[model samples]
Target: MNQNAEYSAVNDAVRGQFLRRTWAMITPYWRSEEKGRAWLLLAALIGLSLFSVAISVWINHWYKDFYNALEKKDTAAFWQLIGYFGAIAAVAILGAVYRLYLTQMLTIRWRAWLTEKHFARWLADKNYYQLEQGGYTDNPDQRISEDLNNFTSNTLGLGLGLLRNIVSLVSFSIILWGVSGSIEVFGFTIPGYMFWCALVYAGIGSWITHLIGRRLIGLSNQQQRFEADLRFSMVRVRENAESIALYNGVPNENQRLSARFGKVWRNFWDIMKVSKRLTFFTAGYEQIAIIFPFIVAAPRYFAGKIELGELMQINSAFGNVQGNFSWFISAYADLASWRATSDRLLSFHQAMSENEQRAPAIDVRPEGERLVVNDLGMDLADGRHLLTDADMTVEPGQRVMLSGRSGSGKSTLLRAMGHLWPAGHGSIRLPAARYLFLPQKPYLPIGTLKAALSYPQADSVYPPERYAQVLETCRLPHLVGRLDEANHWQRMLSPGEQQRLAFARALLFAPQWLYMDEATSAMDEEDEATLYQALIDELPGLSIVSVGHRSSLKRFHGRHVRIEGGRLQEQLVS
Candidate 1:
């Protein structure tokens, strides 16, 4: 083997390792609790798959007799064979239809189960939050939705197809062997092992096809990654298109997109090059298969030992065997992408599971009416300290405000209380994890204003009258009429309107403890003060812990706290 051949061997090793890891990520979903139904569906699918192969066997025989009828010039036999052909074709079509129906059922059921399992895992224990916080993976949305769909589809299709082809190979090999007779070479008669010759021929063809097409697996993987990245970039552009265009950075964005798409272009070129070689070999392989059986049986025909029908049957068997061997060549690109998608989904799921299972540093206990922050400390992911030796207390029905500059440990402190800031040290004893946390950018899920206000709870939880009252009190009277108009409220509303809506949500939910982190900054000072007044009036017994910069916003809070100088303290604002 030369250097290129050695490189090819190395590629095989790397591809094998990649596939093993990818498979490890894929196989567990079936053996899960839903495995009963999943397995039943798959078993049915496989049986149909094998049965389809049985049908193909009948078709192979049909082809043999049909062609032989043509060669013998018997009009009656030819006409009768036409009827046989039609009958077999009808059976093949029906088998194909039911096989497709069963396979689709399996695919949809598997995808639904996998999607639910993955979604649950991703949503559990605030794993989605941490993954974004720690920067472990990109495009969780894509991973959960697009990548999972592809994984379900390509994996099942390829696996079932492989199974059918293997059976076809085994079934047809015997037929090819029986039809091929001995040949004379240089006066020393070679043993009649026509089947052995076909086997050797297919073996070499498969090996060469794989050698040529092996790189396509990784290439296809890279292509998917680049394509996903490009899509993510475009989505980002669309989401922030207003900001980009406001700054007149269209040229810059164009350049950025151009750069990202350039990677796609280059990688696609490499794929084309590999696919070109694969096509060349597979094409030649197919053409040779057309004549290979005839050539092998020609000697017997010249010797007046075989009929034309026998030769045709031999050719049909050769076709089936060769087709079985060449399956890898046909599906090489799909296999590559399927493996890539599996790796992505596996890593995503593994990362989500790891985060979900991570032990919380700050243990929250619902003890008395007061929250005790016991020796609470937090660290940056890089091992730098953010909040150190922190301790704070807030009693039930108390209003506490926290003031901190940008990059201070204020938000980290909130995360610590929530048991999400895992890279931290400390214990935060709260009443329960039932507090309402309102961040700076409120998340308004897509729906009616009433539903957005009543998130995590059904819209029916609040009567239409109270919902309207809260919106009017929060200075969002304009949206009072649009309560039933469904749309993407997150994109449609301004920051101030969204912040006010967050306040309305907090008011509606009535959590015992409400944590507001710059939640009302977007509204004007008067409206902000009014919304705080509304909350105090509507929820007099609600405990409020706020993070805010405005001095005008502190009158509603009885106690003030701060996370600064790497410590937590009472600010004592008068």
Candidate 2:
């Protein structure tokens, strides 16, 4: 294919794919458990839309009688037609109001359902973590929160508008055809001349609109991505404000943020330029359309072949038909936006599906009360060996210290044991009891202190006193009184405090197995020693597998293992 042909072919394929993906995203809600309510609301809204169109048709006919009354100087007939118009307007107003109200109701309900579904899939099987690690999707948070909103609102709005326009086209086409009458052209009589004129006019206008504005779709997609990236950057800075301030990286961050915004700015300029062109053509097209029908039908009225009322009705019907046929031209911008949103949502869904279906190289199962790793081999996603033929077992009530050189995959091994690492081949027999994995930096959700502490668990899971006592045990007694106070605890607390809070969570849950990957790295040696002693004192039988470089951790664990030459080996405790 030539370049243009190739581009057209690619565009067609993309459009087809977009349609399929859009249907896939949309059909679920309509066929879901709430299908009955959804379908009823849709049917009601569509009925209102059709009723509104029917009222427009009635008003079109009323125009004929009202104008004829004015032409004939009949005050009584004019008054009667005005009363008829008032009734029609009332029904039309009610229909339009209810239609909009129902459309919004449906948008919210669909958005709620889709958001819940996305959240469930995202959280299930640690999909969010896998996606982040694999780098398969970007800004999933934005996709779920912002893109879903746009998808729901724009899809419903554009879809319903198209439907209404189609109905209006059909209704008004019949009126225009009947009123237009036959016309002689080159010794041949042509039917529905007005309808044909409207169709041709709208068709030419739409063609030009698409030709000029097709680039907007890709630009809009880029704009959304740029906006999401900028937003995510700002959020990252806020989340890491302390570190950024400590490093004095404000200028660097500002530069990065500005770069992201620059893409948005440039893309928006392209959109504005295209929009300006589209508006220029569409405005002229619409303005000409206003007078074109009147100009076309004037000869019939002047020649006494048609009454003034008929000519007026013909103008109204022609405008409706032309407007309906020009729906694409009018809605092109929203179409581009909706398509971008759909693409983002569909990409997110596909990434999640791919991640969900991925087979793990490491098989983790619950077999016995002891944690066991048999013939485990760890590799990076790109197949770089992290560990090979590593085997170890942690019997019940054993404290195992996992130590290694700075990049020897100690944390990766810890992640593998938790079944969060996917690029490793292994069989891990876990205890049939609760286990908690605390990384070097504990994750404290932004919420009430109780929620942050009991994280991945409800605040109601434990009694109020237990929270206070656990906080006291973890040396976070200051937080006990603030359990009910809502705040961003992660930002409020220092790293040492955060790690201590993680220990408090461990104390509250009292998991049978606890995996700590440098979980106390943020604390001083003395404070770390104290926390380990507290763990030992508070939870007598907690099988602790800790990954740390500190020799100070040796006293807390009974056995020592080190990663050497990409293999696990027993290490002597000094």
Candidate 3:
């Protein structure tokens, strides 16, 4: 399908799902522990909105009396009407203030609730990891943070605005019908001519407005994506500043950022062009509408068929009715944005749901006393076999090393054994005990040195002395004094130091089974030997499975294996 066709399909699907899910998404919060506050706030908002509408109707009638008193030159009656206007204005202002405050309160609460809901789904069952690995969606961060905010606010704003307009339309249309009398056009006398005139006028404007601005929906969606891509590119630069600076990649990075921004810039120009055209038509439509009622009602007054008060009232009522009818025209831009945001959020939610429900390709279970693999097979995403019918087992407390040429799927095999690789079919039974997997580049969140060392666990899980001891044992004695200091430890520490920190983390956790995929590749032979020896000394029963090519690692493992031709071959290690 074409791009616009695909977008429309997705947009329709989202709208269908949104209608189905809106109640489901909102019902819970009202029925939740905070139901009392939720319902109370909702009722107050509704009450204030109804009161505001009532105020509009009252002022509509006030227009008639005030203008009649003015035309009659009655000072006392005019002052009385002036005092009445003050009362109406005060009540309208008070209702508006409280209505806005309540709307904001509900918006934030609803957004928070929905954000937590989406976050839970995104993080559950390693959905985040799978989404990233599969490249199933884009800019999930933008969807969760910004799109959700827009969704809640626009949903409320458009919904309440529609309700108010509909009520105003009905109330004013009735008043207009009663006041407009009749008009003779083409030998046909039409009753309630002003009401019909406003209806036809607004109907034509809405149709033309839609025709002129339909492209904006797609443009808005593209604009958001381009903006997000540009923002993500900058974030990547910030994250990899150290590496980029070392490579002197400022020019390259700038070019990449500029290209992404170029998309944003170009897409926004399309949006602006469309918006400018839409504004031209809508501005003319509204300006004409202002004079339309006066022209329609003036004929009756000039013929002395109605007083000035009645003519003014006719104009007021007609304006309200026409404005209500033009609601679609006024809100078209917001509708476009709202539709785009909903489409993104729905797609993100669908991706997570699909990932969660998909049948697992690898059957990894934690049931065996030893780590066992039986009739295991793995494939890359392109259907290329990496390993086939592989069977292996490691007894408790046994250390094994896997060696192979690059692209032999050694790391992929380790990932499958760790139950992370999804493109695999295997029955791998792991020991029902704590295990730790360390890759070459350990992840160190920016925080205190102590927290980085004890990551995937709280900093307080181990005693302070134990933390210091592990750091010193891992040859990181220099870091002992800086345990409590907070910094970007990943950038602050060298590659070797980060690997050492991973070993320190292993020591602190004391997992029974440890998997290392080139975990010590960054350190020299001497430092590697020292950390491996430290592990063996510190945790005597620790089962080590190391993937590396270094000859020095031979002394650390009891058994050695090689991956070749998609099979495991036992290698003799001295």
**lDDT (CA) for every model shown?**
0.81, 0.88, 0.90
TM-score (C-alpha, index-matched) for candidate 2: 0.96
Please give, for residues 1-574, the per-residue lDDT of candidate 3 as tens digits: 3334545656666664676754554467778777888789888888887788899999999999999999999999999999999999998999999999999999999889888888898888778888888877788899999998998899889988998899889999999999999989999999999999999999999999999999998789888888998999999998899899999999999999999999999999999999999999999999998899998888889999999999889989998999999999999999999878877776677767778889889998898679898888999988999999899999999999999999998999888876678987878998999999999899999899999999999998999999999989999999999999999998899999999999999999999999999998999999999999999999989998899998889988999999999998898877
lDDT of 2 by residue, 391-484 (tens): 8888999999988899899999888877798987878888888888899998888889999999989999999999999888778877778999
Candidate order, TM-score descending: 2, 3, 1
List the pairs of residues colliding in candidate 1: 182-192
After TM-score superposition, what is the CA distance of residue 406 in candidate 1 from its true location, in Å? 2.2
- Could you tell me the lDDT of residue 238 within candidate 1? 80
What are the per-residue Cα lDDT tens digits for candidate 1 across 376-448? 7788878898888887888888999888888988877777766678876668887764678899999988888
Candidate 1, poorest ten consecutive residues by summed lDDT:
1-10
Number of the top lDDT candidate: 3
Tell how far residue 292 is off in model 1, in angstroms. 2.0
Task: State the lDDT at 568 in candidate 1.
Answer: 78
How many angstroms is residue 443 displaced in model 2 relative to the true structure, after the best TM-score fit? 1.2
